[model samples]
Target chain A: MRISIPVSVGIFLLLLWEMGCRAWAVPVYILPPPSEVLCTALSQYRILAYHGSVTLFEILAGLALAIAVSIPMASAMFLFPWVERALAPFLVASQAIPVFALAPVLVVWFGYGIESKVIMATVIIFFPLTVNLLEGFKSCDRRHVELFRMMGYSKYGTLKKLFWPWALPYFFAGLKVAVSVATIGAVIGEWVGAQRGLGYLMIQSNARLKTDMVFAAILWLSAIGLVLWWLAGIMSRRYAPWKDRG
Target chain B: MTLVSVEGLKKDFDGLSVLSDFSLSVDRGSFVSLIGPSGCGKSTFFDLLTGAIAPDEGRILWEGRTISDLSKKAAWMAQSDLLLPWMSALDNALLPRLSPKKSDRERAMALFCELGLEGFEDYLPYRLSGGMRQRNALARTIMFDRELILLDEPLSALDSLTRQDLQGLLVSLQRDFGKTIVMITHDVEEALVTSDFVVVLSDQPMSVRSSYELIGTKPRLRDDSYVVGLRREILDMLGGHGP
Candidate 1:
């Protein structure tokens, strides 16, 4: 799990891959050499970083927006119950159509601005946080809730005391999974119709048959996801230590 | 006047009756225990008494008034010792303060001292073992001046030694508070030791099998041979043939 060992293993694997492609005498257009990809990424570092920033902004903005909107939405949904009744089926139906398919339509409607990318990210990230957190909120120990009720605690008080802790572990788990999907959603939107961002770069590189550029852009995107994962890990340990995975 | 009065209690689920013609009265500050088998209606009675649900037919009066109109006057502490995992012992103990007061951290901390929970107040429930959580829960329950405390086997989930330890602590706390308590437990000796009155209940279509006043003195719960014999007798009555 440590970075040094994994980096070494990855380097060894990349060396093997680069050697195999050379030995099979495959066209450079098909399977790019790892050495060539690394050089392109270094040469184009500023350009890639600017594009990567666009995708990063979209992912984080949507993630924050989703949490702000959905946590209250989940709490309200749980308390009223009818809200969940009315919305859950439609929410599930949205996920049934893959985001990649949805992305083209979103771009067509919203044009190439960051708005489409952010919308895609919000749609992708909202469900997991809402479902897992709502489940956690509702799954509180009935006894604890009754104890509060017996003490004459109001609805708001009970939510703060009895249900909030129960929901914290669940919220963290949903956030972790949603963070990854957030990247994919942002990329999907950017891929469909965007002038900038890593996804757009990869799309353009693929069209030109510049496999190394595509691969390099992919490597940076994966690195971005890894950072999100690492941050989520730290957050779970610090804030929601009760969760098992932490 | 009785702090809690239950009369002509009856309940049925899907055509199966649990309690029939159940009746009991507890003066304020009295200790009462209900001992029974698994499917017995003692727990159901607690549920009804606490307004967790309404019995199909019954009247429960608290402090000489119907609890239906005074729902907050009774506290039911459950067997699992449910503590909020994210909160510190102090905060969990302070949870009852949500009843109406400001988050009374000082009152909760004072209780920690009184309950021997001083050094452990800031620790989370997960950091403490089962015994410690139960201890914290008892401290929490102490904050309420509710006329009646219904404990649904509040310490049942603990191991034997820990359970015994809690029984002593609980007896002392009950004596000090003088809050009317109706504890439901499968442990007959626990019933004998902790109660001014003991009611034994039978299984499904359940009702009180027998009610007895356990006035025999000096810690009859675990450390007494006579109490153990009575426990066996009660077990036998429940059809438990065991070592």
Candidate 2:
């Protein structure tokens, strides 16, 4: 029933879109209907797949880098108040500067390669992951900490046994947010300057007025984001099954 | 013999005194309960006993020697079970053991059986009932393998019936294992039923208001004339402060 409701809603929306485009006599460049978009996606599968694979690599790599960086950073912040205080401004600044503005600079430095796109994705994914994880660590019950202290547990032992387990749910929540936004970073990086990727394809397709192909690229990006989100959910359930009361 | 003694202990939080000139002693193998007005620093006393916090003034003597860091000497349990939700009952019970071995697991299993949590060893804490979770916490405390156990209202969260059952368990555990226990409780009847001595305290800057030595074997019957009369006296001492 859960799957059916959303599927039905999507189909209804697509049907309405197709009929509206047809009834309005909208030019193909101005508005191609869902049918045209679907046809373009199928007919140009090879090109879409090639470009989509590039974007996928950038998204996944960026997400992996973000996780690697954020976990340690969050841990340091949690373990030492001084580290959190030191990095607090820089962490906020990383988010404050527009990614769109940074993308052009990143492309200039990294030269339109996958590296720049990956870095861009990392920049976007870092904040939520770090903050959520730190919050999770901080959320441990005072009584539990006292119990551990009374048990003669060292700081590292308490972190390993108590804080980490307590924070798993929060970590997963941050991962979900990161995965959903991961594509935006990679795609934006590609938009600024890239030899390949769905975003590059969309730019090329739009310039040539093949709006259907651009829509097709968008569809693939959405699908990739959905897949990443689903994968994170699966991992969350595997690692923190206790959080799943249902 | 006296295993632990506190002399003129004083504690303050930002200039507001909690315990002032507090003093008490627990004999080896005795079950002692601290009953006081709500927020009258009973829990603070347990914290001081465990060396979780240092007393502002005075000294804690363990085995007749002034000492700090009683944490290793005492197994502490708070009102909440403090069981890690992700861990099974057995795993939670084995927490104090840094590197638990096969023998440790066996001992934990034995503790689980004794605590009537035999069938629920593999269950996560969230799966257990409130009483069972407290039993799991108790088992964890026992796993600390310390002679002195300090409990801060460990049974306060349970229903009356469950509380009674655990009261009996605590008494038996103390007797069978020859353990020294100091517990903070608000239940007057519970204090009477389980403790060898009940120390009543006044409101903050809490000091010992009175101490009664119960003269019978525990798990004492709550309805017995002696127990009932002592309960009334303790309640009267607490006055409207009784929880």
Candidate 3:
């Protein structure tokens, strides 16, 4: 009942949109109706599949690299205050320059290849992942930390048992944001210079005024982002069930 | 039979003295309590004893050697029930064991039964009531098999009935298992009821102002006039009416 209500509302909205476009004699070029977009998706399935898969690969690869990099970096910052102080400013400064501006530079440095796209996504995802997880580590309950200290648990043990469990929800929160923006990161990289992927296809379709094809590409990108966010929710619930109730 | 001893201990936090020139000794298998007014550095005294913090100028000896030289032989249960929120009561009870064996689980389960938390083993810390959580905390403290247990107002948050119940459990844990127990409380009567000796302290820069030896049988029955008289005497001491 909970899931069906929102989904029904979404279908109702799509229907209204489709009818509104047709009733007003709106040009498909200006705004593709739902039916035209669906037809484009079906007819250009082969082309869409190839580009969608490339975008998906870049986003996932970039997100995985971000997770891999952020875990150790956050841990280093948490475990060593001096290291956090020295590096945190640089990390903050890195985010000050917009990622869109960095995308072209990344393409130039990495030769407009998949490497640049992946790196761009990684850079975009890394900031939130590191910041949220590090904040979680810092916010560990003092009593719990003292309990570990009294038990003679090593610092590493405390991190694994106490810190990790407490910080996991925050990690997922960061992950959700990172995953949603991952598509944006990959798309920006592809837009700078790329022969394949949804972003490149959108640019190509837009130039030709193939509005339906552009909308189809957007649908695919949003689908991937939605799937990633849903996956994060599932993972968070699985690992931290106690938090689910609260 | 002296299990742990603190001599000439002094401590300061940011140049504000807490405990100064404090000395104490705990006999093996005895239940001792420190009862004083609030902000008397009673908790700080336990922190020093547990090696959670170091004294500026004193030594704590566990079994005739410096406490630092000894491995963790004492468990400290604080005023707040420090059960990990993510863990079930059973897991929280067995946490101090680090790598819990099968027997550890059985022991934890047994403790749950003993602590009146039998059916709530799988309940998360948040699911348990405050009294149950504190019982679980107590179970965790005892599960590690430590010789000395440092309890900093472990029952302060409990209702009168539950506090009395846990006080009984503490007495049995001391008498039956011969665990050396040191507790701190603001309630003078609670100290008399639960401990063999009560170490009273003055308010900041705490030192042992006086001591009261509860001379009676186990459980320190209130029906005994001696207990009543001593309680009055301790209250007088706390109220600043003692010599």
Candidate 4:
């Protein structure tokens, strides 16, 4: 509800900019006002839209890849005592190496394509994804656990009823963080080398000092992140609704 | 008729012994209350009888069978009796009975009505008060064909009047259902008023100090002369001199 005021203010600012640019007779290429920006977006909508699609695919693919890997990895960490004990040190150390630092190297090996971008996104998002879920895995109430043992519920049943729910909140929280990281990861990969993308457009627009195009690219990044976060929130609210129900 | 027998039961925690050679036997359908000071092994004995914990040494025989869960004869209600926080009182009570969905709900509702917790069928455990929660726990434990219900100070946290009310209700229900109960309590009067046999326990390294059989009939009497005398004797035995 509070967003209405900020949105109105934002609309007003855009109007002021368009009027200022129109009154000053500024060149469209230098600093396109709101009108020029919107017209350029409409004319080049298909091209920009294609790049937006590519960026979104990279983010989704990275998310899917991280999810597929992290779930099994976290489950192993949960199920097998020794593996978690042994791997904990390595997992902690892996986060020390930043994904931005590795993006260039990934591009060097995989060339100018989606493979590198997806890998970068996975690297950026994987740690939180695994750690959040793992933290959830370990936080089960001992009382409930003892009750399960007393009832003669096997390990699998305990996992299904207790451990899974315990971890679900953390999993969704991780997913929210991962959404933002994913967008950043996609942009980072594009910044290094890309034929087409919002990130590449940002780079090109900034070189020509076209702040409007750069802002538009940034707007796309934020919109994607917001949509993904909103989706995560919806899923959590629908499924892991224990908190609200309480 | 010996319903449950605990012989030479010894439980050691680290180097300290909590219960040493503790032995007791309850007649069939007898309501025995273990009366003791806090830290006495009354709870441990109840735990052993109910198969909540295995005794370090010796054996417990329940109804001619070695104390085991195979026949599902016993249920334990602890001092901090836990209910599934996610479930309603009705559902909580229905836990042990475990039937098909439709039948289970009907039975749970019936049990809730019987226990006087009829209106709070869908409310979670957190929503219920302490007395109401215990009522639910009691219903849950006895919902199955539970022969022995181990009550570990179930009403210890309630107000004095509330305790008295619940105790009277327990006695009436026990008479109606004929459940063999082994309850642990520090209150001497509580034991004398509700139980058929009361086992007095010594303070630490606890063993039976004395035992008394209430010389009263069911539909019990709190103010009966025998109940009053036994209650006084038990309280005096615990070192708090009776008026």
Docking class for model 4 is incorrect
Question: How large is the C-alpha RMSD of every model relative to the true structure?
Answer: 2.8, 1.8, 3.6, 5.6
Cα lDDT of model 3 by residue, B1-243, tens digit: 899988889999999999888889899988999877787788777777766677899888888887662237888889999888888889999989989999999998988888799999999898888889999998999887888888888888999888888888889888876799988887777788778998888878888888877777777776568778878877877786221
Q: Give the TM-score of candidate 4.
A: 0.75
Instruction: Write model 4 residue lDDT over A153-191, tens digit each, in one string.
Output: 568777866688778888999999999778888888988
Runs of candidate 3 with Cα error greater than 4 angstroms are A1-50, B68-71, B102-106, B117-123, B221-233, B239-243
Q: Where does the lowest 10-residue lDDT sum fall in candidate 2 chain B?
A: B43-52
Runs in model 4 with CA error above 4 Å?
Answer: A1-76, A101-126, A173-184, A192-238, A244-246, B41-55, B64-72, B88-90, B97-102, B126-129, B157-165, B186-189, B217-229, B240-243
lDDT of 2 by residue, B1-243 (tens): 999999999999998999888888889999999888888887788777777688889898999999885887899888989888888899999999989999999999998889999989999889899999999999999999999988888999999999999999899879987789998888889989999998888899998889988898789998999999998888877788885
What part of the reference interface contacts, as a 0 to 1 fraction, does candidate 4 reproduce?
Answer: 0.04
List the lowest-lDDT window of 10 residues for candidate 3 chain A: A237-246
DockQ of each: 0.62, 0.72, 0.50, 0.19
List runs of model 2 lying over 4 Å from the truth.
Answer: A1-12
The ten-residue window of minimal lDDT in model 3 chain B covers: B66-75
Candidate 4: tens digits of C-alpha lDDT, residues B1-243: 888787778889887899888777878788888877776667666655545577789777777666653125566676665776655677667666434378777877887887779899888877888788888877776665566767778888888877887898678657877878888877777877888888888876887788887675764677888777777777888885221
Report clashes for each candidate as comma-separated counts. 0, 0, 0, 0
lDDT per residue for candidate 1 within A1-246, as digits (tens), equals 578998999999999988988999878789878888888888988988988999899999999888997889898888888999998898789889899889989998889998899999999999999998899988887767777778788888778766876788788889989997888999989889998888898999899998888888988898888899789888977988877632
| Model 4 interface RMSD, one decimal | 4.1
The TM-scores that each candidate's chain B achieves against the reference are 0.89, 0.97, 0.93, 0.89
Candidate 1's C-alpha runs over 4 A off are A1-16, B69-71, B99-104, B216-229, B241-243
TM-score against native, each model: 0.91, 0.96, 0.87, 0.75
What class would a CAPRI assessor give candidate 1's docking?
medium
